[model samples]
Target chain A: MTRRSISLLGVLAASWWIAAPTGWTHRLDECLQAMRVNVATDRLTLDLDLTPGASVAGQVLALLDLDADGEISATESVDYARRLLRDVAVTLDGRGLSLHVVSADASPLAHLKSGDGRLRIRAHAGWDALGTGTHVLDLTNRHLPSISVYLVNATKPADPALLLGRQVRNPHQSEYRLEFTITRQDATDPSPP
Target chain B: MAVWLWASLLGVVPVLRAAESAAVRVTQAADAFVRTLNESQRRGVQFEFNDAAQRTRWSNLPVSMAKRAGLRLGDLTAEQRAAAMNLLRAALSERGYEKILGIVQSDEVLRRQGNSTVPFGQDEFFISFMGKPSVSAPWMLQFGGHHLALNLTMAGDQGVLTPSLIAVQPAMFEWNGKTVRPMGRETDKALALVQSLDATQRKAAVLAFEMRDLALGPGHDGETIAPEGVQVATFSAAQRQLLLELVAEWSGIIHDAAAQRKLKEIESKLDQTWFAWSGPLEAGKAYFRVQGPTLIIEYAPQRLGGDVTMHIHSMVRDPTNDYGKQFLP
Candidate 1:
């Protein structure tokens, strides 16, 4: 995968998947939305693992099994993923970044009903290669705020050219602010001034 | 490569006899290993007991895929390397030590395959310690590489082997002109337990979908799910015994004293323990978890590569005390 392409999501997922920790404890009647952010020289990726507890699984399933088929088909899984992303906002250096789905995996409906299934989605947004300097990225997830608990953190950047700084999060963790710096080592790489 | 050969040739001399407490033997062995290291290597292998970053720095992937922090076995001299293995031998049972060697050997096989983009071999393994060796205090012994991570915590007479990963890329390979399957017992026992279930039991024990990966694998520290599958409280006498035997494959990897303590603790929670299965009953095609209040073990077969049977990933964790957090306070 090249730096300019969205396919970087797949490559990043394989490498960062093992490091994605679910440090949040799931509640009995709420949804736990755990997000792991990965920053690269040219893109930022997020892996979301949405798990609904037993009491609220029906509510989540109602939104996922739109057709009431009792099963989540491949198309339904992707559609639900897209719908979920609608409530997510990402901004890089005050500029809005567009997000695209790289992959979505829905656990079996039975597993969800048991309150242990994890609906995993990997999304990414690419940008021009960062120049040597500090940048701020803000992300917010307003999905199911009434019954949702959030956990979010940025992984140590996989690319040596990008250095991650302090992370700021709202009490609920629905709002995440990250600071990162582009190293001078990448200064020679051609990019927009 | 020389380190592996050296350890194997010497058979990792045991540092202390069974008369000593498991923690005492482990602490002595750790001290011996550190004494063998040069100043630079000693600095590389020692960390503060509270260094959470280094404590949890472990994975089942190749070094290129997931970097490890410790004294790389390959960098040590033959005597230093043998001392390292001896520390592990002191901490783990005789069989446990062999299993670790088998996992290392399996990685050597993967390296010979020359198919993987990432590096693999006995030389890729590492060993480190969190806190100075002391039989009366808390400390951790961390060792691992591709397909294996053994994080053992010693506190007084207690030893906790939770939060360890035991996996194999080539589940079966040749060693010393003999066939070796590092996790063969884990696979066979799980399958046997699942197959022994009656139709009604199967309905309770089996999941409706395939599990492609571990639910509580590396990096998943504080998170734990509600217990599912069939609880052992409902098991018949014979079936219950089978379950305990299966659970031993994970808990028994520690020294005899600690392994006995863990097994007894698990047995006391029989009513709370649950065994869940996914995929077919055939070996290499199944995924199973033995979860309880204190322990969670997941065995998952990788779909990558041509045969899923050849690649496996499994994790063991103690929900109440991973990385021996409970031992601290």
Candidate 2:
């Protein structure tokens, strides 16, 4: 291994010495793939917080560092985020939604190797105003499933008119289904979507 | 109780000093604090304005885990300790000062319990400064230890209190015959707002999943998560009034004038604000957040110490102006 890579390995080992007692953190050996889904009146947002375990940091880094120069550039970061999102499936009422990258950031290689870094990707899909009525939204994650552990949650809607119902997740949390109803003020509002 | 009596005797209970702006009061109090310290103590607490690392060194952890950059309050003489509190009183509102004192005294309670391996209590708290105390030049006052951190940045008449952590252990305790809860108002106000929501509103207000801790607390600065929960625009006028009052529990912690300005900024963007909660209404052990275009406030009852409500962590940050970065060069 290169000296830089060796230094990272040392940092990763040292990270295990300190136990952080704050927030939602994954210190286990599996890669943590957590997603927060927000459904609004006009748009759908998916915020992903992906962190690779110390033992598997090398594999994750290789996937992010396209040029393998030991660093992830801005362009490379965006490209990797887009590539990951391709495996994600977001659907509303069985209609597949097209998501565009809103923001993407890859943490420094050293930080990632030490298990403290997170690759945050935010993707959004905007559509014409949804018709007022009950709707079903389904999300599936197929990104690095073999080595990844998944956590998916749907946020409370931003519009008070949008009432959320029970959420169902698969055993592995790779598949999530959300039920919601949009209550508009008047019958003149758009028909059931 | 003795500390409160001492503060009263010192005549520095955040009463208005005629014609003095908040910034002037803060700077004068800071200078006076420095004057009371010895040369070594001064060196220990002072830092250059551009010391970025020192500015972010404040943490809600024990001193052993996080080496803070300042003179420990425990190490100071009684006179110096009072001076330090006077500086805090000058920088915070009267209620804010009381809350902070309550948090510090809570640590002393922990020390009395003597269960932990590491040190705990008021003596572990530190007060540090970045840049000279000046009403014109930008400077920062950093104070924190165990479950509390106050980072106030000031310039001229402007002051920003962001990226601060307010937490307590034994969230409720008896102090001189009275029950003291440092974060009590924040808890009660939020519970009131959540309970006031109707069925449909509550359905939209609470999260679909559990949120055991803060989403944007310390170490997660400058990040704006997608706003979740019921929008403030949907609230009735009475409900909106309660929401504004809830927001004040955090924003109003700063000195009066600055707190008012901050509240006004928040109110102007009321249409964009969102309140999200996770956990049952009756159970006080819940996580709630008030997020807006400029403000993010999170309160969570930590799961340690058996009773969740006994250990709590709450954070307030202005995404646009944490550490007063907007005004700095």
Candidate 3:
């Protein structure tokens, strides 16, 4: 293709990119993939994930397990989900943005039921537009080892793009998981930090 | 364009002027009512009237038990209490006075249900006067009982009190085997309005997952969020009328002119509001909730004991100007 034609094509592609959903799903998936955890005991685990470039502040990881078992139950696997979202300092393109937790939900506390393992939890997150760009979800835990799981946006076809999986073992084991979502730029952008 | 804007502004000036005048008239009426109180009655009017301090003390936003329990009208002699009642009658409209009486009588309703033996005691009520009774100064008259809190704030002669939370528990009860309804009529009327909505309107109005309580609980100040999900404009004419009636029942708590002024404001925003509910709409069961832009009302039924649900809790909160924040610096 001619240089001018190539430039024109690039511009068109960029325009479409700007109009897209910011590929936040892609970032979330990436963070989930990189999540690491150390399971020491069957009851609790630890998680680790990156604090993305542009992100909400004070996002903490909450453990969601099914079966109400004292240990990670068979009904559902345990994983790190975001909690306590807040505005935090983010370095982006060399600029700063204020983060805010728009909405959030947590898992119910796990309890030991007769001798069977079970999991129970509720996960939720909503964000207030903060100059939409890219943000990260981080997880950190320090209690029950061998019980950690990291969740990432699922991309496998026929399977949900979001999945909870056990994180790899690490010595520094502060069980936590961090995730990210990239929000493409939009007009009527919120004010900067 | 600027000239056109200016012309429109000029056109609205007369209406604004009229509203201002009406506000003034309402304040004058309220003040006149207060002036009618005798000496002993005036003493009862003071905040914490039963306390030795005599002077009213400023309280934290979501008035604590210490503040509410400290003020008692029952401490006064029978004659003083009577005079105080007269003062209240003068300060509020006839309908407003009736509302107060209805709430007070609910205590007896509770007693009849064996909820409490003490009946309605003075410690159960808290009254505070926001400003001097002058027509010009910003002021408010606030009174709250177990399941009720009413605040009327006036500024530039205008009085506005909305999202008035009025709740009755044991919402349905048998008094001597006859159903006694202290606040059922109003609650049922609101429910009727919601049930009458069309599918599309209903979807718009129902915004949350399970209605539970008013979003604006005590101590949650200036946390009012904009009404989302549905706007009142979607309702049919008949449905809209029902909405207005509900709003009117609240605004009517003020005397006439102020009530009219508030009604006008509420009507203007009808298209940009929402109504939500939680729990079963049946009688004799515990359930409650109401949420809208600029207003939120909650009602819940509670079982005081003895296989009888004989208690209610209700509250109203204004998103923009609750507790007279608009009038404050």
Candidate 4:
């Protein structure tokens, strides 16, 4: 979907839903959140949950405040973060795989700003990586850990036999180098680490 | 223990082994525990020394979400559990062992309260080892579940406990007919130190940006963090002593002899240690940061929907050496 539609959703959330107290001050409380990546046979489901990064509020405000009006409409702020998902890297076997903006909701963003004080934002992105042979899955994390605390789990639930192991980043990078090995039907998979 | 004492010990490896130091005791204890694992359990517990992914696959996340490798406490038999606890005794000081047990017991309270849908209990904790346990070889003892992740690395007679997580939810909970607070020392001593600072000192000590979680934590291995907050050099001698005491509350979580050596390293770098805190200093909600040339400790409360200040997330790391780096070769 277009960024315009995503922004409209945020605006509707702000006007339709109630707002709570928010600011950098929320950092005062303890915040522990996680981002999970569940691998399916044909596609990869990426989830960003737990809580929005500590810096997300300010970052959204800065990006969406285009009019220099010193005020960012709820839609603009939420859409600004959604647009960032475009840069979310999902690759198969070392090659970049195309990602579809599956669904983006601003309720977590809205509640995070005011509602229940959970400061949560749940977003999902998916891409096709189905095949018969072996494949490797990897992604570059943008919002979660760099902004706050995030734990990534890359697992294939359908085939218990397939093993998924992750290789993390350089000091300056936020990439998860996941190597997935495929074998013949008669062959055995490598031992899990 | 002093640097000179360490130097003299280094000169004589045989005496270091025969003196019954914490390293030797822990090695013996670990050896005994490994022997009790029978056959299949041993395969699950021991990972190849070069198994990079397994070594780094630990987390403070819930078990259902973040899985761990190694033999879990729940899987052990009665005799095996006793051996596991004995190994912990050899690795941690009395206070440290109590801290680990207290954190584990809090999970048991959660199970009773029915706040969680997934599995949780004291027995859910796990133990794992990387490389063979020898007094002279470098090895690591990793034990954690839910709110605990302890990575103790030993190199010869020297020891380091860093890149570890010591966090608990429900900051204060009623358990075993008594009120329990796992991170009580970290919370109380940090507040006292913050209160001790005057206006000028407080200005330097309070961080502008509120830290919601530890800046350096799991998966942030080898990352660099610049020091923030009040440096120990500016404090009075008494205040500096207080800072050292506070540090000991975390570093000394290891065995006594090893912990003493860890303290000596920090004491030598008093001028470099920094203590910074965010949020109001009042009891319920606050975050504190303590970083130095060799150490980094953080304490932050978890905002789990309820306005009640109960859940907490804290971490302790050694910037230069974590996961027994000196022994890797």
**Residue-level lDDT tens digits of model 1 in A22-140:** 11111346787878787777787888899887678998899899999889988888888889999999999999998888888988898787565768888988898778889999999
TM-score for chain B of all predictions: 0.93, 0.93, 0.71, 0.92
Q: Against the hidden true structure, what lDDT does model 2 obtain?
A: 0.80
From the highest TM-score down, the ranking of the candidates is 2, 4, 1, 3
lDDT of 4 at B170: 55
Lowest-scoring 10 consecutive residues by lDDT in candidate 3 chain B? B57-66
Judge candidate 2 at residue B251 and give its lDDT: 94
- What TM-score against the true fold does each predicted structure earn? 0.64, 0.67, 0.53, 0.64
- Off-target runs (Cα >4 Å) in candidate 1 are A1-84, A87-193, B1-20
Give a tens-digit lDDT track for model 3, residues B96-166. 66766666655445444443223343335655565565466666666665555666676765666643446
Q: What DockQ results do all the predictions give, each relative to the true complex?
A: 0.03, 0.06, 0.02, 0.03
User: What does the lDDT read for residue B123 in candidate 4?
Assistant: 77
Measured by TM-score, how close is model 4 to the native structure?
0.64
Best by TM-score: 2
- Between prediction 1 and prediction 3, which has the larger DockQ? 1
| List of clashing residue pairs for candidate 2 | none
Candidate 2 residue-wise lDDT, A1-193, digit = tens? 9999999988876674333232211243567787777777677888888878667788888889979998988888888899898999989989999888888898888767756567988898776677888888998899898878776766655466877775766766788898878788332322112
Error of 1 at B285 (Å): 1.1
Comparing 2 and 4 by TM-score, which wins?
2
Against the true structure, what is every candidate's RMSD? 19.2, 11.3, 20.4, 15.9
